[model samples]
Target chain A: MNLRDFRNFTIRDYQDLFAKGELVPRELLTIFLERIREVDSLLHAFLFVNEDRAFARAQKLEEEGRDRSVCPPLWGIPIAIKDNICTLGIPTTCASRILEGYIPPYNATVIERLEAAGAIILGKTNMDEFAMGSSTENSAYGPTRNPFDLERVPGGSSGGSAAALASLEAPLALGSDTGGSVRQPAAFCGIVGLRPTYGRVSRYGLVSFASSLDQIGPMARTVEDTITLFEIISGRDERDSTCAPYPPFSRAEIPQEEEVRKMIIGLPREYFSEGVDSRIVGTIEEVLKGLEKEGLTIREVSLPHTSYALEAYYIVAPSEASSNLARYDGVLYGLREGGEGTLQDMYFRTRTSGFGAEVKRRILLGTYSLSSGYYDAYYLKGMKVRTLVRQDFERAFQECHLLITPVSPVFPFFLGERTKNPYEMYLADVFTIPSAMAGIPALSLNCGYVDNLPVGLQIIAGPFQEGVLFGLALFLEQMLSLPLPLPEIGQQRRS
Target chain B: MPGHVSLEEVRKIAQLAKLSFSEEELTRFFQDISDIIAHFEKLNELDLEDVSPTSHISWSQPPMNPDEPVDWQGSDLVLKHAPCAAGRYFIVPKVVEKEEKLS
Candidate 1:
């Protein structure tokens, strides 16, 4: 099967292929790895690939001869990791020069869990340095092009994870969603992407961006694949104080037919503002109509504070990032350039020279926002607004089962096109940031296409309401006929 | 009615963040920080006399468990990644007197 057809196969299907001994895990993994080798120079989806180690894991699993019911959920499944998540003995650079060649001695808590559940690490995927930008172009390794259109960017900082799944480089991929990093790229790539509720998944090992906003989730080609990976990773961990206890995720079945029409979907007016692409709004209307035909009721709701979320996010994220990134002082876990003079100069030189332009830009912004005189004026005020944003979601969900919106105002833009202006890049995150500010979960699925590129419909649910999100996304998948066609690679080849 | 964030304050923020800047870059940073601060001055005009500052999106309930000192153990296997050392002591840059450095 081609990469397109292969990604459509569920993790269960691939495992069954392995169970019947029809296709060996090593052979299946190599098929995708070879595709990555042949195509990734143009796509730049992966930062590294550990073929030998991945093969070894496959060999061990094969000898064990355990089916998924007895084995782990991820047994023999190849998965892509966002570059920021630390993997033991693998470079966890966060796509920044400051952390060049750095290797972790232990996996991040989520990484440890995924491996224990039977995933084969395909290597780190590209991302915005420090998960700061909306476009993968901010990565020091270079930008990841959208699989659909070569010159266009894969949405960031989880861009590569999304691109890897889109390209069929892996059946499943792991990415962190701070704002829209997971959902936006999943939208642009026409894949099933979920951002689990905050604390639903542990974050002890994921590199800090905005501690309050950050979460790791899965990207795959279908709703079921995303659900399978989520069930495996969601749980509390002692190492992360933020992780909360979850209901047994194994019982998280797709909402049944009897419960189907009971869903209350809300359309927030603030989400479909003047700037949103009309065509996307129209596509969402059609989805709502189709769902209504199937017995789901739709209501128009208001989240007045939604407008301020993007601005509030900029202040709060940078404020936390400014503090969290302090450890990368060319001291621990980064590129350290040895220099003469006091220890201060060594830190000064290493950070100044090592970090790229976008990372430096963010660190500066974050530092100022959290600085002495400005803390309350900027950072504290942002936090107040953040509360309002969260309250907005809480109020809307009071009237509905889920909130639907465009994942992004516009579709993916050409790489280097948006990089020259950072504010423009920030605006792309407007629709996605509200969920992050509120610590709610949102998923992006291909609803329809405009001008041949895919447009994603975002389904948002209140905290710990992933069940609602999965139900609606799966229902839409069966009801909506506009399956996003594969990226037209030939007509849109990258430079 | 307002405190100006001077060019020097902006530069100090960069220094605290471990970012060394050229003279020209420092001047530009000063300008950018000033412009951003000016734009953010809208908050002070809000007449927020009684609003409490919120730090997280979620309400801060008292944590389910109280913080207590624990006798945690560590192995050199993990500690080897620490940046500074003289035996077990983390030898940080001496920014203050030894008395002040006691954490």
Candidate 2:
């Protein structure tokens, strides 16, 4: 198959070809690598591409040969990984100068699982430095542009993974969502992303941002593909104490249309409030109306504490970050500066030079909040407010099986538009934060497009209810059936 | 709560964070952090007196794994990435001054 045909092929399509002996893994890898060579200069989505390793893996898979019945799932599949997840011997920079050239000696549990399933690692995709920002613009290397429009951001810090999938660089990718990193970017890039329930996946080798909030989620072009990847990487891990004591997700059959019609979806009133763009609200409402027409109930519910979620998140996330990021002390690994000075000076200089502006800002904010005098007032209070936020979701779930909202408040903004204003960037995640704070499963799927930019409809379910979440997503994916053509890149610039 | 984050506070926070900033950057951080803190004060408006803080979402305690020692094969590889190392020990600038005597 040619490049165009390759761009349209999903994981299943490639598997079908492999089964028919019409394609080899190495041939597919070459096509994707060639596309990356031609397109990545414009997108800057990858920090490092494992070309040699990928080819070796693909050739090995070819030699092993595909067995129709016994071959592992995801065999010969090329997948992109967000830079934060550790892959042994590969540089996991988290798109920060601090970790430049620091190759991990161990693989994250997800990486081990993916490789065990016969998936090939494409490379490490770019992200905000330490996953702090909502835009990839904060990346120390560079930003990953939106596939739909080169001038706009592919909402971040998982922007690269989303952009790669949207641009057809890879069919499956992994991203860590501390806040809206995965879902917002997925929405902006017109792909599928999920933030599974906390503890649903192991966090053993994934770099920590916020201990309570960070989760490695799967991203793909379709909900089914996303589900396939999610099942592979999720389940209990002894290494991660936080991982729930549950088996890997069993493939629950997607509920039939009749059963789906019986389920009720709640629309949080706060998500559709004044701050959200009217176009986005309208686009999601139209989808809700269509669902309503299909004999599904769409009830308006209240998440009163939603207004305080962003504030609490800013406090809790940064506080955890300041504590988690203290390991970079110019000694063990990563960049070091001013070696001849005192240990304190070496630490100060290394951190000051290695960290970018946003990272330092968060570190300082967290330090101040967790410092002796302010802990109760800031960090403690933030946690209390988080409880309120979770309660709001619990109450809403009592009235409905699922909740739907816009993934982001507005369309993907142009590059450098919100870079100067940190608060403005924080507002972009307003819709995704409440669900994240509650630690529930949330998925972003393309529901419609406005002004030529894709609008995402977010479906949130109670903890461990990812099966239900995927069912709704699959139903909507069929209903919308929006043809996601390969983006024309530079050709579609706004005149 | 408004305009309460002073330059001294920003400096202290930076020091505690082990990060440094120029005079100009310090001024900018003061303004930015003050604005952000002011926004955070909005949370105080709600009465959360009875609500317990949620440090983690799951209420169940994590089950512990057996405490067993296992050989780690990556020791050499781990030390290889260190900026300064001497025989498995990471080298660093002196922590204690020469005049300070050990207790």
TM-score for each predicted model, relative to the true structure: 0.92, 0.98
- Please report how far candidate 2 places residue A124 from its true position, in Å: 0.4
Model 2 C-alpha lDDT per residue in residues A325-384, reported as the tens digit of each score:
999888888999965669999999999999999998898888888988788889999999
Candidate 1 ranges with C-alpha deviation above 4 Å = A1-7, A481-485, A488-490, B1-6, B27-50, B59-103
For candidate 2, please provide the TM-score of chain A on its own: 0.99
| Chain B: TM-scores of all predictions | 0.57, 0.87
**Top lDDT prediction, candidate number:** 2
TM-score of model number 1, chain B: 0.57
lDDT over C-alpha atoms for residue B35 of model 2: 78
lDDT of 2 by residue, B1-103 (tens): 3327778989988988888889999999888888788889998898978989999887345878899998889999989888888897988888998988999
Query: What stretches of model 2 exceed 4 Å from their correct place?
Result: B1-3, B59-61, B101-103
